[model samples]
Target: MRHGPATRRGRPAVSGRIVLRLDRMMVERGRSLGWLARQVGITDANLSKIKNNHVSAIRFSTLAAICEALDCQPGDVLVYEADDGDDGTGPRP
Candidate 1:
């Protein structure tokens, strides 16, 4: 059997937390993923995941490394975008 897309009903399941824009900052700094990872003593894959926002959790140690390498504050690396209505699903992109 196959399944079809469900009809939009209640609030959309949108995440109130918008993604962090660390990748952009990294680019602006001309830093490569491998370079940052090496500087911070983390694996390249791990850094890539964080850069892509695929990480669900981060430790204070890791956060501190990133902040130190980038010479920026935690707030400078992340942004909080409040969820606008549409339930949680959010407005149509």
Candidate 2:
């Protein structure tokens, strides 16, 4: 089976990364894990796993549910940080 975001050496991919900002969104929305879980119809434990980036994949349905519950778009909760091929400094685009 295929995996996600892992390189041949089993390290996270260097080119790019997907970040879950669920915890930050929850905090900004003043919502508890348990509460959001209830709203999203998922278990708190599962949500926690996603929040902590322990899981490599998430279903589209789940993502939609979370987006709906948070009253925000996907971009508000997910972020992409380009690695810039090892150079870290750059002016804002």
Candidate 3:
């Protein structure tokens, strides 16, 4: 049977990647978006958007306030993952 879309049979592609562990970080810090919003005086919805990585841009002051309140560095909020293309088996690579 024909499998799903073939991936050029071994060719690899490079793409920029972004990793977000904000949810985990918030849990570890014993803080919620609401609390953070109150602390930073930003809307909870805004914080949620950032937590879900749906935010397109964020002000430096807001980021700085979050970092200060959470006592964590930017690295803790964002992670980097290399782009490894599918090996033609499945999406998991």
Best by TM-score: 2
Give the Å error, residue 20, model 3. Answer: 2.8
Give the lowest summed-lDDT range of ten residues in model 3: 84-93
Please list the C-alpha lDDT of all candidates, in the order they appear: 0.76, 0.84, 0.75
- TM-scores for every predicted model: 0.69, 0.73, 0.67
TM-score of 1: 0.69
Candidate 1 least-lDDT 10 residues: 84-93
Mark the regions of model 2 whose C-alpha exceeds 4 Å error after superposition: 1-14, 84-93
lDDT of 3 by residue, 24-48 (tens): 8889999988998898888888888
**Model 2 scores what on Cα lDDT?**
0.84
Which parts of model 3 have CA positions greater than 4 angstroms off?
Answer: 1-14, 85-93
Best candidate (score: lDDT): 2
Residue range 72-92, candidate 1, lDDT tens digits: 887767765666533323455
Estimate candidate 2's RMSD in Å: 6.3
Q: What tens-digit string does per-residue lDDT give for candidate 2 at 1-27? A: 545688878876667667788999999
Instruction: Provide the lDDT at 53 for model 2.
Output: 83
After aligning candidate 2 to the native by TM-score, how far in Å is the CA of 7 from where it should be? 8.4
Clashes of each: 6, 0, 0
